[model samples]
Target: MNPYSVRTLWISDLHLGNKDCKAGFLLDFLNKHDAETIILVGDIVDFYSMKSSHHWPESHSQVLSLLMQRAHNGTRLIYIPGNHDAVIRQYLKFNFGHVEVRASHIHETLTGKKIIAVHGDEFDSAVCHKRLTAIAGDVGYDLLLFLNRWWSRARQRMGFPYWSLASYIKSKVASANVAIQRFENAAIQYARRKGAHAIVCGHIHHPDMKVLGDELYLNDGDWIENCTALLEQHDGTIQLIRWTERCELLAESYAFASLQPDAVSEKKDEAA
Candidate 1:
């Protein structure tokens, strides 16, 4: 297949310095796709996990290198720091080579639709007000991801196609679904207040696209559980892409609302 050329590409929650990051799959995606503007919607690196144990592999380094290459190649690069990499927030309004750092950005799509692009953590009430509750949730989520990793490997060995055990289980979780709904509503409300037609974010690691009246809510998903990204076609039509294997691409335009949420915390919302 020919390379994927898009108007905008948004991906997030890579958790690069953590073991659960699927750097290999992302590497392939990066190699295959190129956009006029590449938006790193946040949590591109897992600073919180690295604080306790750093796990930077070569593939992770390559991913960063490739991004820099894109920047130097004249692609508009924007980085919005999520809670995991919130320290980078101090550098907002600063430029790192060809990339610009911002807390949130007002973006106009090819079709002239205004969008409030942010990391979406600020709108999550649980992450902001309940510190202990957030941490406990993280612990539970970590255990789930651990089991998911092994389950995926076993499936791979048995010649089954790639499936997200974590995402599947999260679909059955009521509390997680509630949290996700709250975040989505809050984000949509904020966008409406800002007079934007849509909101794009990636803190919950849930890949989604929902049309509410005249507004839209989009999440690019994450590299870990879903291995998905938000892709804007040349005509400005947006879609969620599932990048499982290197050459396989699954475009689920709207059937992903069920696979919602990963983890959220005051400081440690890894995509895993």
Candidate 2:
């Protein structure tokens, strides 16, 4: 639980203005772990609705304070805005209170591989050009969140741990899976177009790390579902890590296994 043991951390989809942000769990994760750099992938705040109703809670403030402390202590912080907070796009190239915000960025890993870091909303057909579709998706998403919240509450009362109903359905529903697959393909293709060897994104709320052809695709699942993050080790070895239920490092596809060992070794060397 020592915060000082980690190197780099990337997380997304906190939805701070939403009541379902899970700030407590996030605070626990932040307090328990330390990283040299922290990447806030996007949608850290639910800006879409913040204009209509102000809903920043105490826990939300606490999380912000935690990040501020880390940044003050020299942790490099990078933020890429998501669709929900698209307003930040205007200030993407600026710094906000110790956190650097960007629309998207290409990050070079320690192993010299280039990775495209973005929120992935641009790839979703329903999200990109159509406001109506986006609103519909939001409506559906809100219903799911409502169900998930009470469902988890009931589960807890029954001695079961919290679980994401939306995520469970996302993994099983054919249409949802297909959409996610398409999004993944688009992201990977975009990475290729951008001359990147890997792509790390959020906004779909699904946590996954997969390899397709010569590229790697990673999604830092949202707190609403997988409660996960994608981490880039010092040597450029990427990992999909979860934060709930004791914190787990999930298995990731080794599409480019040849590139991994060297990265891990380099990380060790850097640490040493």
Candidate 3:
């Protein structure tokens, strides 16, 4: 399959430096797509995990290298650091390599619609105000990811395709679903306040595209779990693309060899 050329691409929750990061899948996605603008929505690096134990693998390095290469090749790179990598917030509005680092950005689409791009953590009640609760939630999420890794590994051994155990569990949990809804509503409100036609953000790791009345709310999802991204087409339409599913399709067609390894073993040691 030919690489998809898009107007803009937004991805986040990479959690690089964390063991659970799906760097290989991200690299594969980057290789298969070219965009005029690429937005690193948030949590590009898991500095929280790195502070305790550094787990920067070769794949993570490759992901960074590929992103820099894309910027050098003239793609506009915008990074909005999230809670996990909040240290970068100190250098807001600065340029690292060819990428622009900002707390938030306003993107004007091809259709002349203004969309606010942010990490969205600022709108999350637990993340913004309840520090203790946020920490506890983080711990719980890490445990979920650990179990998800083991489950996915077992599925692979049984010749089953990749599945997101964490994502499925999140859907089943009432509280988690409510949190997602609140987050989306908060994003929509923020967009309205900003006078934007829509908002694109990542932090909750839930990939969704929805129309709330006359406004739109878009979440790029996360690389660590769902392996999804939000892409803006040339005509300004936005859609979520699941990288794992795309890789699986490519593997089935025997079109790309790079995604083959990931399609078989996407699980990583828990430390997310």
Candidate 4:
């Protein structure tokens, strides 16, 4: 069975040392997909949470090992440290074999659009206006994620498909929605300042992609609650795929193989 081959794969908010990290799902995704380049947008390690409640299982370790092995095997890996693991910022420009650590990276899609890869905390800090306030907000966000886990489990037992309780709550809350909007706006502004046509980031754990005026915004989401990844096809099309929802439909190794260009466009041409 062929694998889902992609030109670039972006993933972030792994929070490897945290209990909520979905290492198993990430492993499954990595096993099923092949990418020429992998961008670890940020929070790959939850050093912040580790200080308070350490929880690193074998699965998490396996994920790290596999990524390093893949790097050694010639896959290009770029890591951008986020606030949670900002200690790596000191190592910016360093290379551990095929892996490169940088403050940020500008990725040029096959279609020639330049997109900056970042952790998105800069936008958060700018929008939140204060470090203390951002920390307080994080505490509340964690509570929502805790509740989201239990709610998801209960729903699955009752035969419901996967859903994000945290996302639902965020959408319902006025403040949360405002913060998200501000964050996205800030991201676009930053991209414009950097001369990029698009931005790919992950911090809010909200997987989304949209064209905002002349700019494109893409978030790879998180491994914890959403289990989503952003993919760039060989033809330069971007896809935001939530693995949890499609795992059943993609049990076959050849599922989504090649992720080719638009079939709808081909159909239209044929019709004409």
In candidate 1, where is summed lDDT lowest over 10 consecutive residues?
263-272
lDDT for each of the candidates? Answer: 0.78, 0.74, 0.77, 0.78
In order of TM-score, best first, we have 1, 2, 4, 3
Tens-digit lDDT string for candidate 1 (167-246): 88887877677777777788888889899988899988788877765678888888888898887767666666677653
After best superposition, candidate 1 residue 103: deviation in angstroms?
A: 0.6
Q: What is the alpha-carbon lDDT of model 2 when measured against the actual structure?
A: 0.74
Alpha-carbon TM-score of each model against the true structure = 0.87, 0.87, 0.86, 0.86
Tens digits of per-residue lDDT for model 3 on 216-268?
77888887788988777676656566776344211111111121222223332
Best candidate, TM-score-wise?
Answer: 1
Q: Considering only N, C-alpha and C atoms within 3 Å, which residue pairs clash in candidate 3?
A: none
Off by over 4 Å in 2: 126-136, 253-272
Predicted structure 3, TM vs. truth? 0.86
- Clash count for each candidate, listed in order shown: 0, 2, 0, 0
Any idea what lDDT model 4 has? 0.78
lDDT of 4 by residue, 141-256 (tens): 78977998898889989998777787777767776666777888899999999998889989887778776767877888898888888877786777667776354211111112
> What lDDT score is found at residue 11 in candidate 3?
92
